[model samples]
Target: MRILFEDSPDYEMVLGDYLERIPISWSRDESFGLLKTRLVAEPETTRDLAEKVMDNREKGGELAGSLLSAIAETSEGQDWMFESLTSGNVRKEASALVMLLNLISSITEPNLDHNLRLLKANAQSVSEDNTHLLLWCLEEACEKERDIFVPLLEEVLRTRGVPAASVYLSRPSLHRERPVSALVLAVEILEEKGLDNGEISLGLIGIYPKNREFVLERLKRWISKGKFPDSHHGMLVAHLKKHDTSPIIALIEELIDSGNRNALYVAANCLEELTQSISEWLGWCEKWESDSNKEPAVIRSLLEILSRLKTYEASGDRIRAIELVQKFASRSNIDYEDSTKHISLGKYSHEGCANTRQENRYTLKRP
Candidate 1:
């Protein structure tokens, strides 16, 4: 049972002991015992995994993860595990490395070195399944990013059937902090695959405009169509390196005037870039204050942006915003408008910092 096969896939295959030559291999019971006795990456997750694996006996990821984790506790055990996984790599089987990725979270890994060797082997994936595993590792690499991760990501993108990877890399990322280098290359790959994604435009944030104009052009269309949002991406337009922002600004103003609550949030979110339109913001504040049917979110965004003027290094704007606050509070015609003395402040409490602008180039004309 202790004999290790040089070809790792042989372990996954069933042997006919009666017709074939007899050989000692680990019994299924023995292997299962080893995995059951060994600890896994995450306890809470492992418990759920164990339940799922029990319900369906075919899933081997948790079993493999358990076995690897148990064996890799010791230096000698780790060496053997690495060697066996390397054999799987030589065979171009993802079974071993899939186990590695399974041990880690879908999001990130706490200790990347534990899987570094397997990850490097996966850079040149042998099949579609192998490339899928590479994308999983790429997500982890992007999460707890390092200098080595970028090259690894590039290699993964260069895999024979890279278009399959675009489905994932081109999706919207909720995380504000993302690996820009990997994402930039990912956007290029997505572009090559002809996958036009408005939600994925954030990946193009810091890409030089001269490097690719089509992406920016597509983003402008999405923004105009409201497929891509400006609310969360305050710095997106600036990062696009477009000298003519007037068209984009007009599109944004159209959204704001459309009376969409979320659009107001977008205006609030992008007030820094929209500072040139201070008069417009003031007008909106006055309009909202005078109207009896205003939503609290609307007022919240207005006040929030005004409150943020303190951090904007613009004294005139700050004073004007403050006075508007006082005037809005003083207005006795509306119900609870004064209670909003702090009503707008109550909805969200956000910290402020100097707006960061990274230089990127793209020529955009509002179509």
Candidate 2:
């Protein structure tokens, strides 16, 4: 383990001794075999065996849990062994550092925080290689072990600002739609450190309604900053419902008139979400549709936005929505051999628009 040697001045000698006795192959599986062998025969060689486990797992194998289980099985495999190795003591020896990371891979057992503190303490004494390895281990551990790791992560976020803060906030592993969750967790950590204020908290909370109070307060503070993007606005609607929709609606109206087609598109999308009445959003939709100079791309995007509104059961403007559907339906008037294949792209079908007369009779009674 690199971290092991980083802490011990005699790590090179220790590594040399291990290499001579341990018959580890360059391949990950072979190295794991060596560790398993050592686990059976040389119980005292826990540190070196642990290093092999780390190396083997990094060599691209699913050996982390198995290796950790083997190491943890014995009394000689001190609970703190992985911590000691990751703390930078094993830095001079690459094998040892890898072993520690591999050992803990995906198992996220308790007591990692106490061990993390030990690693942090040794960080000063360890070499740069060990220090980086230790930091990476800390980050990885923090990701899965959120309970204890959160408080520690907050401290790290407070102490290390900017890029690190952004780094801490973002989890590269997450899908695009899931990044907001990680950002929300990161905001909580930042808030604990007092490093995050209302605006930043609002941005995250707007993305995650569970963070409602923080988001609503923050949004109120920063509402003048300009209209939020569609995702954020949608999140706000969920967070505050229609209670705070008035101001956001005003902003959406301004965005629709901003002259920027992209902004207008997003504004129209927001309008589609805000008012219960589709008629209110239809004026902007009509304006966009009337713009003869508007790019085909903008029109296509607007059409898609209207299509989304048309599908909502709560939309208030059936007449305008039906009109939009008719407009788009006429444009898609290609003759078809099969009626099913002749599906139109408008807001609603002729049958559906006619059916709405009956639907609106009951819908008009909703508050």
Candidate 3:
């Protein structure tokens, strides 16, 4: 049980005070006697007691081994010890649990299955005040006993939402083989519970690339119903741009012709993502320009795209886009001021602008 608390000054200081409160009689047990005594004294406090014991430095390993033997001797002793150690403030309880877990693992040939189950059960009872420690314990359990810890991980995601679940799910080990069932449930919870867009984006990103089809279908359904909020438009577009550009492109085109200013901006941004080159973007402008039914909103979207290209420092692309914009303005008999005002020049270059272009250029041709 080599807990890495020696380097933590706060843990050491807290442990020093915590140990002094425990009666020396508690150290009388031969297995834990020396460890309890040394922990109560000076100089040994600064030393890496856990590491020294594991290394057998000056019989430290023997002392540590005895402590484990004592802990494993009976379920009653283990239960009492755990309850006693954790009956403190949040910091104290966390440190005690961490140390206890390490001690259990350090003993040679220790039976860990039962102890791990106890830890998992304790983890479920943690309150918000001790969530950080609970997450740490869960991660440790994942490393030590993945099969047992996975269900607990799902429970955390289900009850606590993405803020707590992401701490564990984002880990490479879990992220690579993310529990899709849990993630899908989380998405449903997030949607029904109405979490912040940022949190929703985090949840989506955590399960991204793997769940592209699932996400795209959701976005499509949302867009078709005109239920997709502007808050999610950017993140949804970003994720869609990565895996499936067709839906994004179609959505952008539909929104551009819908005559909604906000939706048009969202469409313009999506167009910037889907466009491969200045020539390709110009082609879209030409198509819209030639359309007899193209609305003022479509022209506005084209101007917005041009402004974004300039902001991106795509000088050549900007020039070509600007040329198309000027042609549209001239044909409509609209002056530069109206064009600039309609396009909202200099606004789309920054992040807050609804019409800002994405930097990621896709090579996939539009379907």
Point to the candidate with the largest TM-score: 3
Model 2, 43-108: lDDT tens digits are 545445444444533431123223333454344544445454444434223333334444434344
Q: Candidate 3: misplaced stretches above 4 Å?
A: 1-89, 96-115, 139-147, 160-177, 217-244, 254-262, 273-298, 301-319, 326-367
Evaluate residue 115 in candidate 2 and report its C-alpha lDDT on the 0 to 100 scale: 43
Write the residue-wise lDDT of candidate 3 on 242-278 in tens digits: 5646665566456546654554444444445556654
The window of 10 residues in a row where model 1 has the poorest summed lDDT is 356-365
- TM-score, cand. 1: 0.41
Tell me the deviation in Å of residue 48 in model 3: 13
At residue 352, candidate 3 shows an lDDT of 35
lDDT of 1 by residue, 1-367 (tens): 4432221223323211210122111121244443334233334433343233323334343243333443333454345445545554322133344445534433333445666655666456345544555565566566555577766766666554346446445444444555566666667666677656542455665343443454556554554444554454545656643455445545555655666545444544343453356665555555556554443433565567665554523255455555555555556454333343342222333432222000000111112
Per-prediction tally of clashes: 4, 23, 2
Off by over 4 Å in 2: 1-50, 53-66, 79-151, 172-207, 213-265, 271-302, 305-367
lDDT of 1 at 57: 38
**Superposed model 1: Cα runs more than 4 Å off:** 1-59, 75-80, 83-95, 98-118, 138-145, 160-164, 167-177, 198-218, 224-367
Worst 10 residues of 2 by lDDT: 59-68
Give lDDT: candidate 3, residue 119.
74
